[model samples]
Target: MAAVGVGAFALALAATWTSGPLATGIGAAASAVYALVADLLQPSQRVHAPGGALLRTAAGRVPRFGRLDRPELAGVHPADGPGDRRAPPPYVERDAEPSVRRALEDGGFVLIVGESTAGKTRLAYEVARSRFPRHAFVRPMDRSALAPAVAVARRRRRAVLWLDDLENYLGADGVTAPMVDELLGRRPGRVVILATMRSEEFRRYDAREESRLTGSDRDAWRVQRDVLNAAVKIRLERHWSEAEQLRAAAHREDPRIRLALESGDRFGLAEVVAAGPELLTAWQNAWAPGANPRGAAVVAAAVDCRRSGLRRPVSREWLQDLHRPYLAERGGPDLQPEPFAEAMAWACQAAYATSGLLIGNYSQGYTAFDYVLTASDLPPVPDHLWDALLALVEPADAYDMGLVAHQAGRLPRAAAALERARAGGAAEADFLLAIVTGDRGRPRHAARDLLRVVERRRAALGAAHPETLAAVHQWAFFTGESGEARAASAAFVRLVADATAALGAEHTDTLAARHQQAYFAGEAGEVDTAVRELAALLDVRLRRAEADHPQALAVRRSLIWFSSLRGDLAEAERELRLLLTDAERALGPHNPHTLAIRSTQAAFAAQAGRTEEAIAEFTRLVSERSRLLGHDHPHVTHSRLQRVQGLIAVGRGAEARGELTEILEEARRVLEPGHRHLVLARSLLAPPRHEP
Candidate 1:
């Protein structure tokens, strides 16, 4: 269709060059013929052609000038010529406040006010379009044109008059009291007026006049502001952490960029330019240090602020505002300034050398960055500082940070931090040390260390104490994770008994102990007992903790896995749906927990009869996991295997085969050959071939 239209247009132009007046007549006649043919053929009926067919079909339906098509008229009125037709107003997508749309629908005039680029004009157009879809839309060029446009719209009786950037129209006179009174007194009809103004400008209008026109006095405006504030919602946009950002910069194939990211200095585009060759050299270094650009920036800024006589410890808000202009001046867009500032604040707050008197307080606030910042500035050698710093050195804190660093694949740092923390006298320090040692391939030492922590905690705090029992439980779990199943089972049995007695059978702590016991039982070749224990615990959790609670959802997920092991795919799928819905609502749509549930559901769906649905779900899950968790993460690899299985079940065997081959290669690289996930990947590859 597009090709045919282009051909006709070319012919029309050729005819025009040959003869002026007669050519114009020929062009008009040709356009009419084309329009008739389009009407008869019904352009919408053609769908198989690619490229511009859809565009041609849409253009063919637009209102024309006299008998001439829209395109023919456009050719006559060239875009740049004086008095040439302006392009039809851009279609504004209806995607804003529902209340504003409702008011427009009910024939009420609207005055929208917000900061510039706050989507005010776009929102106004959307509301107008939705309310008067079939009517002509007249937008006045300025305020002087508004009254005339409104008069025309009123006469038309089915038109909407919009005055965009209405503040410009109001001028210094401030929406004159008399003019507003006249507008309010105008007779009601099909015509409606919609306008937008800056919030500050709107305030300058006479109160009585504004009230009469907008039907909202100053008190009402305050109420609206309060309501807007109360109902404002925040959405989390995807952002990279400092470590992730460094990894991304490294992957971009620019050595200088990699080095700048790794320097742990305050990094913006300027720093990248400044570091140039040094950055490249650092990237080339075989063992360059991990980047802490955010951290360095925070420290640098804090020092500068203090030196400049700023009273407050460099705050996250202050750092962000300072960095904004710096980044802008360096020709860089504002990107994750908050996190970078937060990282700086944390460094200043956590700096061990900062005076306690200046630090003020150290507490585990909502954000880890805040906690670290508060901890860093503790006073030198004060009793509270000593106590707080001692607490920081405790095994629990060290162990937590160590585990996080380890999971993030910073093994050396995790090991060093854990070792230092253990040395500072954490009762659970040995447990953390054991895990780090195991990660470093010293399994025997790891097991020994874990056992020592359990023994020492039991001896010092007594076997019944929460700390002693927790140590015992974690030691056993880590032992199993490290591949010492027999020893782990023995530890688990003791943990189960002690936890049940001390924490009570239904307590979450005891339930956690039982959960570990179930896992150990499965490893020790007691599958039936494991299933029984897990089922009982799941039932209790469902009844006690709401199904959506994280702990309860976790237990439900376990039940699905156990059911799958027992070849009860139907039951597994039912549980997966419930868990998926609960996780989606509680943890949010794209959260890791929800993604895990979706992955499980995909596997179960394939196992059941919903193969096509399974394939679709798995495909989405694999893509999301790859984007969010990285392709090499265990979860992503697992999801790929599930996807292959889903594809095979849906009879897309060729595609499944290719996916299986990829999964096999990935699994070999990232997992032990004997790993359960690797085995699953292999199983998916064994399916027979068939067409999609």
Candidate 2:
């Protein structure tokens, strides 16, 4: 509005220098030009993030190793830092540092994989800081902030997406393949994605075959696999190598390194130097004899809370309430527990003149030392702890805990926590609850839940908001899962249009909607339309992302099936063979996509009348998929069916009938009533002989 006024004023000023009709015409043209230029002058606004280092060079915030505070190191907390004590030691370079720096310098996703306190975060931060010292640094607190953080980094030109402890940003509504592709492809070398993950967490995402997962695990892993695959992974060993220890010996001038060296080759140099084992030992010893058993219980409660995904610090009052069950479980009054004040003091006492079992003061509340979580052999989180945590933790914390529980396969507990979170007005819980509901095999219920969430989100956050759009996307998926393929296809059509308008035609979300649109279109029997749509989408994805990118590969996979359905079986088989080569080269022979393509090729061969060759191929594919994804997985079922068909073709009807009977029984139990596989298996089974 202000720009329009200024444009009018400019028009009037210009008109004063001209004459009559020409003056009026010139002024009008000048006015239009002024307004157009004003509209084009809009610049990128710097959005403020509450946490993480904002190392924007334009603002003079440059990142230095220690002087500029790094994101809290992997194990060390703010309360555990070297304050009065001399700086622990100069950083001994890890073996993976060169590879890490190389990845950072090249500007793409770089993941440092290691166990806790193996110095994943430290290695990533140091390498990133050294490489991109002046670039903006963004560390989103959770998955919710990821897209916005990426946007901020994009605007800053040179930036780093710092994802320390990468688990917090994974799973549903988390970072995925397309997001990474856009970030890396759009800006190229202007930005870098630096992340750290625990070795176990990385392994969970590194699934060789998608059939190994079912329901929500399958859905989540599909995206996670692509994202992890895109990353240049650098592994850091928990125990330092002999060369690393010898290098640490040179730094023994620092007493911490000298002390750590005295432990021989048993532990990581950083783990020992950071007092991780000592703090854990101190906490455990507090449980023995007449020591602070009550205090140990309090710390144990805190650790369990942390393990349960409560990232925020808890109050002493809440800890007091939570610790009682632990105290009672460990012999109750017979343990001769100390007074609350005395116990609190003992638990807070520092170990090795460094960190205490539980860190933080009264003001900040208390958090269990992070190292204790990595080092200890704690049991599964008890029901009492889950019950108490849901009751005491805030809605946001409960939401986080719910996600962790859902990821850990504790569905009932996850549902309960997510329900509490929803009741407390945590909007994200609604979408997650819908996913959890679907995971529990209640697709109709899940669709209804998502419908409500979509309506509410649209009303509250506007129809164009990403969260609302995401809810709509999931609701469409659940609608399809509930057997409403036509409705889901229609939903994706509208979503594609809306997402294109809001997030641009080339945006990942828009492309994702297009992919889904093609899928449901095929499912709804519009195979020709699906083929055209997927082919176009694949072209766009190939232009933007690498040819080997997951989205592109997925589009090609769908297109092949649709093409086959369109009666271009020979062409489809040839395309599938080409796709198999690319899949094997990019994703490995054992990857789900590669295996699926091979299975399809074998099926095509059986259809093409090469029974002997197809039988052998199906035999191997079935065995491999069964081993990876389990015998009951849909992929295995499909392969076994193909093999049975091969047996029938080769005049082994009796053998085929026996296998078909077993498959029909298994399908009846594992598949939905209307599932195509179940229908196929039942149809293939011959009727029992009528003994008149």
Candidate 3:
């Protein structure tokens, strides 16, 4: 299709030699077509590529486009006008408030979305006002504005990035794509990017690009999706009840009225909001040919539900043919736009609201891009349309769909999609299937699947390929989980050597392989050698990488365990503190990595005879870990065990025994019987025997 576009561009170039309105339009349209294809052909950024020492050392000094153009004072809210100094409006409780607060507190990101009238911006301000009372509310409308905001936030050590109508700035090829990327990529916990966009707009931004992607700069959606997958999504209900309508009318008064009346209140975008969360079908029924704003949405939604990601879009001719029948069935062919073409023209206008386009050309039919509609959506496709499209295309481009679903943590949907991919002979899906299976607690099956990938890729891509080696390493990992520590250990040793020889000693894969080798070696009972090897790896890493680089932090992490295993409690304590400091500095105090290190810090403190401090640390870790990783996760279980040990250490044996009893039951339920923590818990809780 794009090749055809290129050919059309050549014809338009020639036509431009003759000056006329038709020629001008043709030339401009052809250039756009060519540009779209050119954008598609651009290289995908390697976001996951490892950063080296230079980048790490220059972290704080790196160029930043994350700052806000106008940063509000944290200490004081600007008076609206004429000394109308006042408190913000009271927050209306919503289903998403808890989740929004949690995401903000977690120091990650959140995207609030709804229709124009859904109060998305209001929700964002309320959230910030509630959670970040002491920090500035920084909002940026353009990419350039982000840098100043980020700069202030970083300097202050905290700030809320209040981005309203996010699509205006971060949409595909928007002016501030680089700035948005920089803000999202580097800010982490230092600055929280709380952005709002209409769901309709957001859904459209990547609908076309993602569906037809050959690989390109337009893959920003992929990055944004991945980043925001970690973020909390607060989508205001698209369905508006009568009660909500009344509340919006009564409470959301104009800012000017409040200012003149000397009432304390923050200005809101309420007046700009259009009413009605009307169903799409109803909207379409109501729409007429004369300047109907809903035409594009109707078209976008129709395409979303009808087009399969794997197939070429339905041609304009095909759409017209189908739409004619659709209108007839609704008994509304006489509604307003007598001709199907006129209705389609309206659709083109409405579609600008979403990330959708109606491409028309002499040679090809109109096509839809990345719009997706599901049964859950307000404007979901009617069953007849869905059935037609189902027959028209393959179920989906399952692998691509599965990858996106997996990243979004939609496990069941991911599995269903990948199952289709596997049926279609895509080997990549199997690898993710294995991960999904493991997460579902089917380790045996997952291990078998992973091993198959490793063997297959090793033969096809060669042992030296980074992907093949990664598979081997992952297979070895699941091999351990599926119960073969010694074999897995041997495999890791070989992988480390192979990685070093093929990729060079300083390669990220080699470093990761070495780290794995050290752990498995210890598990295989080569504790002394493992300790020495880990210490040696740490030395090499510290020399080559930034002191707090993730790899170096990982190395120190392993050494702390080795130090403990070697019975050097003081050395272990020192390493734990060092690891904790680095982790806190690099990932933030509340980061999962930092929290894990904190647990180890407690264990070290306990072993070093800091009884009171150890108990406090362990208690903190147990509660935090439970909240973060869940109670059944191994990390939480292990932390609990350490807490038990601390109780025993303090001669609170009865309390220790009681805690062990609870842990023993929990271990039996959540862990394998022979699991190290399970075994330890059993021994600790075993009843004392009296001499017979």
Report the backbone clash tally of model 3.
Answer: 17
| lDDT, candidate 1, 265-293, per-residue tens | 54332123232223223212311123433
Looking at model 2, report the run of 10 residues with the lowest lDDT sum: 19-28
lDDT of 2 by residue, 466-565 (tens): 6677778878877876778999999999999999889899876788788888899999999889989988888897777658765577678888888887
Instruction: State TM-scores per candidate.
Output: 0.40, 0.56, 0.45
What is candidate 3's local distance difference test score?
0.54
In model 1, the runs with Cα more than 4 Å from the true position are 1-430, 433-449, 459-462, 482-490, 519-528, 542-546, 564-568, 609-612, 626-631, 645-674, 678-692
Candidate with best TM-score: 2
Candidate 1 accuracy as lDDT: 0.47
TM-score of 1: 0.40
How far off is model 1, as Cα RMSD? 29.0
Candidate 2 clashing pairs?
none
The lowest-lDDT stretch of 10 consecutive residues in candidate 1 is: 362-371
Q: What is the lDDT of candidate 2?
A: 0.71
